[model samples]
Structures are given as C-alpha cells and as structure tokens.
Target: MATATTHGARDHARAQEGNRADAMPVVPASAWPDPPCAAGHLVWAETVAGGGSTHRVLARGTELRLTDLTGDACAHLLLFAADRPWERLNTADTVKVQWNAYLGEHRLLLSGQGRVLASVTADTSGRHDALCGTSTLVRNSRRYGDGSPQSGSPAGRELFKLAAAKNGLSARDLPPSLSFFQGVTVREDGTLEFTGSVGPGGSVTLRAEQDVTVLLANVPHPLDPRTAYVSGPLEVLAWRAAPTAPGDPLWEATPEGRRAFLNTAGFLASRGIA
Candidate 1:
C-alpha cells in the first residue's frame, strides 16, 4: 500500500505557524460603538461562515444582531426558553396571531404559549420570511449533489442539528425555523415568490424577551432559485440592553402584540424576575 505522508511530515513544523488565524476571530464589544448597538455593551460576537452554524444563550435584555456580510447569506434561527427548553418558537402562532407573514421592525416572535420569545428591535434588511424555512439535507443533496456537513453545500437542518446537540438538544426538539435575509411572498393566486437579500451589510437585531437559547444555521434559503450554492457569511453580535417595559410603546402597538407582551411579563413575574 502506498502512503501519502511524505509532504506532511516535512511541513509539520511550518503547518502550526501557518494555521494561526489571520485576524481576530471575534470583535469585542468596545471594538465599535456604532449605531443600532450604540448604547449597549456587547457581550458576544462571532462570524459563522456560509453553510456553517452557531448557538448562543442570551439573557433577557440582550439584543442580538445578525448581518448578511454579502448579499447571499440566509439565517435560519430557532429559539427556546433557557429555563424551559420545551417552550420554543411557534411560527404558525406567530403568523396567525399577528395576522402577518412578513416580518420587520416591531414584530414579535411568539412561542406556543403566547409569550414573546423575542422582538425585532431593528431591521435594515427588509427581506425576511415566515414561510419557507431553511434548506434540508435531502433538498441540498438533490440540488447540490452533496448535503453532508463536510460538503461545500451543507443542509441547514443538519447544521442546526449539530448546533442543537452542543446545547443538549435533539432532532425531536427541533421545530420549523424562522429565516432571515431571505423572504417569500404568497400571491393572490396562492403561488410563492422567493426574495433574496436586499443588499450586502443587511442586518436584523432581536431583543430576547426571556432568557433564551438561540440556534442559528447560516445557509442558503431553501427557496433560492439559483442553481449553484452561493451563500455568504453571517455575522452574529449580541449586546446588553434593557428588556421591554410595561408601558413601552411596543406593548401598545397592537392588541395582539400587547397580549403577547403581557403573557411574557406574567411568566417573568412568576419566576420572581420582576
């Protein structure tokens, strides 16, 4: 049998030196005190490559911002209450109760129990989706030839599963996700139109309404009509901020939104969180 270790053996010493990261992997909170997050002290920061994944446990009042560095990134996000993992994102109820499919600033992400898991505080990327979640392994393989995690075009579901497993979750705990940087609109005829990102540098910030575990898969939108796998990188940043107040304007924005906020407040109060 032939062995292929000759080159690697000669370059072992050099490999470690060259393998070091070219730049800071994470941007500190004080690195940039910019708009959107100008007031808060950032607590977490990361950049998930295309087809990659990540997870975060955010405390209530922490705001997370996801950016599509390039115009092709898609963010599939799943949320679970940190204290009670069983309570998770319920998109159907989010859309049904809100009476809207498209999402933007001031929109609340509701859980099955009618609690506001998170709320969109800022959104520069107008394109988002309540329909057509993220891509799956079967679909990725059918389209790109290989959907394995090691492949060039990995499935969003598999990436999510990997992220979830790190936080002690499993496939059964997985539910449909809410996608960002990509969108879908239903016409009067009941057909679907997929919308890609408006442009590069688009971002959406979500404020945790409760202490929550957030799982993110930065992959292509399943509905993207493109034949090639051309997604871009995703930037995840979180900063410390105050949660909603009882008399805040968002709480009174709509009858439905107010009810969701009230439910969230009740849960917090019961836990003696004041």
Candidate 2:
C-alpha cells in the first residue's frame, strides 16, 4: 500500500504542475486532531454503509453540529431524556406542534409523550426528508424477498430485540423516527415524496431542550451490497459540554451515529423507555 508520504509526493507533484500560486496546503492526517475527547461517552456503535463515519458531542453550552459529510446521506435522528432513556423522541408530536410537514428552523423535536427534545436551530442546504423511515430488516425483507449477506444484516434486526429487552418495552412501543439531510418533494397530489438529499456536505445543529441522549447509527440498507462498501466502520463520539462559538469540529461521523448512542443511553436512563 502507498504510505502517506507516497500520497504526499503525488500531491506535491500535482501542485508543482499547477504553479505555486495555485497550489493549496495539504493538512496531513497526523496534524489533524485524531478525533476528539467528546467521543468517550459513546456506548454503542456499528459499521454502516457509505464511507468515513464518525460522531462526537460538545460541552455544556457548546454547540454540536452534524454534517452529512457526503451527498445523499439519509440520517435517522432520535433523542431521549438524558436522565431516562425510555422517553424517546416523538417526531409526530414535533410535526403537530410546529404545524409543518417538514423539520427545519420552524420545528423542534418532541418526545413520544410530547415534550420538547431540541429545536432545529440551524439547517444548511435545507433539504431534509421527514417520511423516509428508519432502516430495519422488516423493511428490508419487504423490499427484497431474500438475498445474500450483502442485503442488509439479519443481525441488524437485533436492535429492536435489544431495545425491547433493555427497556422492558414491546416492539410496539418504539417511537417513530425522523430522517435528516434528505429531499422531500411535494407531489401534484400535495403528498410528500422522498427524493434524493439536497446536496453533499449539508448539516444541522440542535440545541437540547433538556438533558438528552442522542442516538445515531449507520447500517447497510437492506438493498445495498455489502461488498461495495469502501469504509463500513462505525464511529461514536460524545462531548461532555457543548461546542464553542467558533463552530464545532469536523467529523467524518454522520448524524445517525450520534442518535444510535443517544437511543441506547436514553432508553436505559430514568425515563424508562419500556
């Protein structure tokens, strides 16, 4: 395999051809912070589709930002009471309270019982999909009758089972989810349709209404082939406090990654998800 030096040499050669004035500085991997300390709180993680997945949080009052990182990424976001994991995010109530079909600056996340989760304080490239549901083997099987191991993991189904056992809730008690950074188009019938995302590198930031445990995960879609994944590694990052004013750190992590950990923690917390 070509070492970082080899890649650097190739980049230098390209820069020389472009001219010194046109060349851009290349930040080495070593120079960049190797992820952040905020990741320590992560309790659960899994390899997902797409490449370069990671997650992290900021300190109290510190702003945590989530970027799609790549274009066309659909992220499922959930939040639970930090003190009680059972009290999960309620997107339905959020939509009702905001009186909007889509989530954005106008909407705030609500818990299953109709409590505020977080407000959508910022949305870059305002194209997020609300109807696109969370990924699961149940949905996958309906899409593809039967396929190879590449067709989403049957193991992924364990998420629900685990949730049921941990929270003491039946499968029926799971909360509905919201998909972020997706495209929702109103059709001629005035119905919302799930299209592609707005574009790559879009993001959103939320200010917690209460102490909340956010959950995010990146698993292969039931329809995608596992062999095609470039880097299916799972990354989980957490922050003890909110981020500083300058902005949050850049992470290869997807919004889904954060939600996964949040879900587990919240479900187990005092709220009692079951």
Candidate 3:
C-alpha cells in the first residue's frame, strides 16, 4: 500500500515511467550520498558526530542508505518540497497512510502525495527507536555544545516557527516537534512524556517520490522528566521518506490536530503555500 521497493528496482521503474533516457549515477557505499536540488527532486540525510550528506535520489528507483557509522544514533528528520516548501512531507499523513505506529525496516516512509521517499533496505542493528522528537533547542545544544562549528543561523525552534508561520499555523499551535531518535511513554493518566536515546547506530531509509528538503538535526528525545526513568536510552532512526500529492494522508492518528494538519495544508495551497 505504501509503494515500497528495493533501491535498484524502484529507480529503474521510475525511470521507465518518467521516460527519461538520462539519469545520474548511484551512490557508493563508501561515500556520503548527495540529494538533488531540482524543482521536484527529493533527498534524505543522516546526521552524525560530523556532518554528512546523502546522494540525491532523482528517479523513483533511487534508493538511499544512512549508516549510523557509530553504534546507536538518532536523526531528526523533516521534509519539504524543493519547489514548494509549504507542500511538505506531513508526518501526520504518513502515519495515517501506513495505518500503524512504530516505523521500522518493515514499514516505508510515505508522503502526503502518495509516493515513496525512502525505504530501509538494510540495517546491521535492529534497535531502531520510534517516538523520538526534534526542536530548535535540541539542535543548538547538540551542535554548539558538542563542539561543532558556531551556527550563525537561527535554531530549530526559530526555524520551526518560521515554517509554521509560512504554513499559516499560529504560534500557539506550533510546538517543538521530535523526529527519529527521541523516546516517549504513556503514563497512567494517558499522558505522553519524553525519554532519552533509544540506542546507537539505528539507521532508517527514505525513498523520495518528488523533491523534498530533509532536515536532520540532533535533539532531546521526547520525554517528561517527572516520570520514572525505567527505560534505558531511547533512540530512533528514520530510513524511509516520500512526498504526497494534494489531499494525501500524513501522520498516523485520528486526533483533531492531525485532521487539521491536512486542512491546513489545503488552506496553505489555496494561498499558494504549496
């Protein structure tokens, strides 16, 4: 249902479907793949101690591989269209399309436009964590505090705020979001609290249907400090991703917020946000 396929096969099929005679070369395992910057191109990235890149998947058959390089690491992933940042990879729609929680090698990252962005073709470590989250504070702390180069740009929170505003979401509705690598737990009162790292080297893949702007930043896992620290480090890795057509499903919930996400997207598109 999610339209997932192996790297080689997917690319070949997309090439045939698009009737393109010329395509770019593939990524070598030893090198970091770079994504395309075309109007409809889509790409994925995995962040490590040192910044890295991914080879751009131009065709439907293109496949992406993200190596933890380390044992267990988390990646905060976000998606946007290369031509239209407003028309993005809505997480809520993705969850709905899959009709399940906890994405892994078994599941494919889907887009609101009904296409595969990436797929987890292989993984050495089976300890991929779901429920991780990302935000501006987390990115800043990890990058600047972790001895990375100084960032003259805005932080995650700021960027998110800007994106939200551009998407027509009020500041009140836009909160810090978590991506791959954060952890969470339901409480007795049915409350969701943040946890820590899930594990290390937990990689995930994303196949691109169209061009997307993927932002992977390190951040604190979703958890509430007040709760008991029963679980160990919580980590999540996202391997698959894709773009959706107009009026597509994203995220995996029946909550009002998720429904509104779709409505908001449509509204944005009406206003030319997409």
50-100 per-residue lDDT for model 3 (tens digits): 222111223333444444434333444555545554455555555666664
- Answer with 1 or 3, whichever has the higher lDDT: 1
Q: What lDDT tens digits, residue by residue, belong to model 2 across residues 1-274?
A: 2336988779777766734221122122122234333444322222234321222222223333555655634455556665566776776656654556677753556676554556565688576655544556555455444322344333233354343444344556556667666556678998666555555667676665566655443433322333432223322223334421212321113243234335433543555531
Evaluated against the true structure, the overall lDDT of model 3 is 0.42
Model 1, global lDDT? 0.87
lDDT of each: 0.87, 0.47, 0.42
lDDT of 3 at 237: 25
Q: What is the TM-score of each candidate against the true structure?
A: 0.89, 0.55, 0.46
Clashes of each: 0, 36, 70
Best by TM-score: 1
Stretches > 4 Å off in candidate 3: 1-47, 50-59, 69-72, 113-116, 120-133, 137-155, 158-178, 193-195, 222-274
lDDT ranking, best first: 1, 2, 3
Clashes of 2: 36
